[model samples]
Target chain A: MSSTINLFMAAHHKECDELFAQAEQAVSEGDWEDGLFRWQAFADELEKHFTREEQILFPEFEQATGMTGGPTQMMRMEHEQMRSLVNEINKVGTARDMDQFLGLSESLMVTMQQHNMKEEQILYPMTDQSLTNAQEIIERMNQ
Target chain B: MNLHKLSLDTIPPILTPFRFFLSALLFGVLAALLLLYSREDFWFTRWSNSNLALTHLLTIGFMLMVMMGALYQFIPVMNGQLIPGSKKLAPVIHVLMILGVLALVSGFLFSNSELFQAALAALGTASGLFALSLLPLLISRLGNQLIVYLLRVLFLVLLITLGLGLFLLLGHALPELNLPYRFYTDLHVLWGLAGWVVLIIMAVSSQVTPMFYVISEFSPRYLKILSLLIILTLVVMSFYTVFISKQSGTDSAQPFIYYTLAFLLSAELLVFVFYTLLKIAQRKRKIADVTINFYRLSMFSLLAALMLWWVAVFLPLAHLTYLLAILLIYGLAISIINGMLHKIVSFLIFLHLQKLSLKRPEAMTLVPNMKQVISTRNSQIQFMLHLLSGSLLLISVHYPALTVLAAVFMLANFCWLSWCLFQAYLLYLESRKKILACPEISMSL
Candidate 1:
């Protein structure tokens, strides 16, 4: 039961990582149309992941732990940071500026990877332990 | 799990790590200057004062300085707990380390007893305070346990290395102490190089390679086993050198066992280099990142060093050993660090600025993105300088007269590194000021 959340969320993180690589590769290869398609797919998947955590998992964890301003808040802030970068990358995508797109994507990659690390390595495990209905919470997040 | 420990805000003030990074580059410049000043005499022997001074300057002055700074930033985040009072401890430790390295290098260059004593005091206190601050975090069972465990051993080895260093310094400061300089210094170098430096680099690679390069994680169980074997071999070799080899001083078999141990250690490092290269090649992100190139070059250097170590053992050439050390130190370790500095500094600036923008939403537009903070053009130039100087330094081992030319390039290499970092810092400060000013008008109203 405890391992379920870790397994589920960590898999989602890997899926997002794969999407990110595909998007980055397409852009690097100068396929603007395909690159934009892949990038949008990545951005959408990432937003959905962030939403799942923030809307379902985070509030549950917060309620379970009775702490509002903690790791979740930091994660929320990082989500906003990534969101801004995602928006910037969209602008770069439209302009088809390879260097600008690469630069913005690189920053997003680092920011997103580090955020996922913290969540997978620390927060998710804590979520597993702190919440008794781990399966149900993960189910909610899946939707 | 202390919930408060997970707060990313616990990252030390920007200056804490940045000061150390900039100072490390300056010391790198100092090292190159020492090379130019000493000229060919620096290559006279591994035991020469000039040689020792140069090694310390690069090792303690540059490599260790940067490592400590990275640790301050990395450990807190990785362990999910900040080192206690890190903001205060970091600056004091940075100053002491700087003073200590300079004093230690001076003691070697001039054979000054007072300088040696000063170095001992400064370094001893600095490492002591740092170790004390980091102990709780290292002991915690949070985050990645293997990395935490490896970090714990790194600190322990560092203490042993420091202890050996101080004993050697005592022999220099007070000749009457009559310490066996050769024996103790061998142990010191072994602990410092193989034990502390190599292990930390490998540990860092395990974490960074997967995260930054989009590769699969190295098998932790396998890594743990490999780490244990390396430590076991080091312990056995040290024990042989200290006790068994001395008892059977005339036995040719003793030297054979020593060489065998050395080969085994080199083999382990070879395995690490190959494994890392394979991972780098396997990275899903096929971007032409400068840092990935740095990793490849460093791995190549490591492979070269390992082969040279084997050759040095069989041939018993005086200079080949020196070349091996140079490859390991400058070519391998320093190259990886140089690459990391670019990524870490840029990301740090972006992170802090992002945090600031989060606080002051109006300032969001003012933040410089990561690439804007440190342009790829600047880093690519730094890479070329680093490669040229490193190649020249390798060649200087064979042709001693080229030492000055190598030194000049080395000086340029470090100065360029300094300029790159300084430019990024300037960008950070400029962006930070603009961000702060955004809130000013609102508050005034």
Candidate 2:
């Protein structure tokens, strides 16, 4: 179970990084169409990731730990911030202004890269260690 | 987009309801002070030292402070992750931000002096530190493209804005340096207003609008690109015009760009308002809360004000401009803040109480409904008074005496808001005490 969770989380991290890099390249080239597309893909992956956690993983953790109102809450707020920025980026893209797109993209890239590092380093490992019944849970998630 | 595991115990203390109350009170007092001291003659008369000081007091002191506290508490619940430095750093950031605000406000009111320079330095350092501390928390959640983007944009803009402000302050303090004050000031306002303030608002609105209404999530692709484009255009156009003005000396291009940006911003705001209203109309929850009502009213005011602004652009009437500013600042912004505060405070209290009840099951009854904490009647009265005061003040710009009455009414409204919040806090304390006393009974089985 632990290994499966680790594998999935690691894969997720790499995907996020790739998206970030793609977004950076697109913005640098001033190809806002591609930049916007990559950003949306990045956001979509994140939204799916969060949904899976909230619906599948978080409940299991809550049941196992008998604790609530901690990391889950923080993640939700961060999601809100990310969602807002995505909206802002899209707005800038529509205006088709390179400076605005780049300025926003620059900030988004830094924030996204940093955020991915933290999750990959800390949260995933912590979860893997704590959840003893991870194999069953992973199988259930797959099903 | 890693689904990391985290335990409930990892939640930070600074993200609790108590800290929110503390931040809110501090910001409220500072905002009130700005309102009391602000001169109508100089209000929006071109972003001067005093204007910058007052604006920062509202944006950094009031808005950002509240936002940080809310974010600290909220992020944990949203993401299942704890903020790394929330416990120790929250208070440190809060105190520094408060002191910085005081220094900047006093310095601006008094004009160029050693104290002003010290205040600017304190504020700049505190803001820098706050941004630094937020880096870890921000980094942890980078999987979410939308939030990561917003934070990055806001932080960068904040840095530029603050840096320019510091330069301007230094120039004022030491005139012998011979810095081009006008140039820096223009850039500073541009970064501060367009870059930091508007971008953050836009970023926050995307999440808030959907969450509040439970609407279908905004089309991420369109929203993200659109917001970035608008802010970027405004910022670049502002700097470009400024550069052009310096070269041409008698150019009106700056005003033209300003008008264009305003129109663009208004259009964007309209889109936001429409989406929000549409969602609200479709909300499954039939029973409307006070916060939702206030939110709806705020949206109406925002739309009306935007239209008025466009009209005034063509008409160029002083009265119309004053009216629009009042509607935008006092009407739309304040209304939204009021609504948000009511909901956020109540939700925080509920979350805290729920947590407490987990340990002490007997005190479950003590947890108050959100309605008890927020008084709709009081909010309604305050909103009406604000509208009345705004209308009167707009007319009173010509008849300056009327501003006194507007100020008086505003003071009363602020007092009422403070009282309501205080009352809510008291209720929260009482509820906590009851829960603590009956711990065994309140514990979750």
Candidate 3:
């Protein structure tokens, strides 16, 4: 119960957001190399965050609450949508299509941010409440 | 912990808000064209016959239309409850409102009693039905406390505004009431602008700008304070109008209370504009967007309007009030609405398409991404036309002939806006057909 699910997950979201912003800034400056590097870091961090939710947190929360389709379901769906966008961004980055990359990146950034808001505001708080063994879950998520 | 209370299923159909958006563009073009044909003397006073018609065409015809549609969409997002009978009521209200505003405008323009009566019936019914549609959702447990509070007040205030407007209209329609039409009309304007429009915009911006654009969240404490000041000012103004005015029987006290509330209202709006500007300046994304252009222009226009309004308090200038009204209504309000359309329309298209693709992955190949729904280049051109129109409008006050140029700009801007949305809608239709052609759709969250 002392795992601090909201703060820990929220901080990870912030980390991903910061990386995304750096990638975005690089693309804006027409530095495709830096853009790709930062974007890869952001994508990797995002995948880890998704794994923590999908593999550990969401299953645990669903089991505790016995609710399969709800906010988490929506979040998972949005994450899929974002993952596709990330793929498009990666494709454009490789092609060095600056205009295309910037456009796709802006779209991705909006989707990601709104998704984070919903998770941070609704899902994480619910996870904190429903999961009794939150401290262990946090340790596992950290790992 | 309230995740069960929130669901993405609560959102209304995509067409609900788009219907209003398209109508607003039509009305904007109409309002501009109406200004072109009106006599030169119409701009001389606030109460001139044609001026009344023109103003209502913009305020009721355009602004109110868009706001109602947005509320239907916003309530579900902010409250997590779909409004009961919304699908059934939205189209009905839209038709009623369009008919009502047209009737009202023609009545004002021609001084026809029959048209005034028709206007009363149409507008009154439309406003009532609009309120009825929101009743169920308003009673639900809203997640955001600030938005919940503001919406409750805004709903009530909208009815009050409509009721007062009806009272004034009756004097013109029936001619038996013999009311001081101007007296009640001012109160009607106050509640409409300050109570409904300003409050809702403030409440939405408090959450939306932060989330959608990745801007830093504003201090809710400051918003709470601003809300209180707004309510207090409205209460004082109402108290003065309803009670104190009859006792004094003089025009002197009216101007004092009016100016005081005006100052306080503008100050609150200035704070909103200032905060929005800062948020945009510090937004995480540095890439150029048509929506960002609209937002920046909206803030600057709002600030410019407030500054001009402040200057008029000390210096006397002819028709300065008209200029101030232009900037506040068209410059600030319409500009923000345009900015919001770019984002909201795109978001809806993007969200719905994703949902469709999720339902049938095979149909995804036919789906266009968000960036392709409404192209940046097309909207940028739309924004340029808007900027040119707005600038010409400001200068149109001194030289009446310039209004023709402004009208031309407005016509082009609106035509482009309509074209952009039409293209997106066509894309939506194509994607929708592809999804339907699939054998089985996965009906899941």
Residue-level lDDT tens digits of model 2 in B334-438: 666666776666555654664566545456456664545555566576567656655665566667656656666766666666677777778878888888888
Tens digit of per-residue lDDT, candidate 2, span A31-64: 8778778867977876776676777776877677
CAPRI docking class of candidate 3: acceptable
Summed over model 3, clashes come to 0
TM-score of chain A of each: 0.96, 0.79, 0.95
What's model 3's overall lDDT?
0.77
TM-score of 1: 0.96
* DockQ of candidate 2, scored on C-alphas against the true complex (2 decimals): 0.05
RMSD of 3: 2.8
Better structure of 2 and 3 per TM-score = 3
Considering summed lDDT, which 10 consecutive residues are worst modelled in model 2 chain A? A106-115
**Among all candidates shown, the one with the greatest DockQ:** 1
As a whole number from 0 to 100, the lDDT of residue B17 in candidate 1 is 83
lDDT of 3 at B52: 88
Q: After superposition, how far is residue B383 of candidate 3 from its true place, in Å?
A: 1.9
Q: Local error of candidate 3 at B148, Å?
A: 1.8
Tell me how far the alpha carbon of residue B186 in candidate 3 is from the true structure, in angstroms, after superposition.
Answer: 2.1
TM-score of each: 0.96, 0.70, 0.91
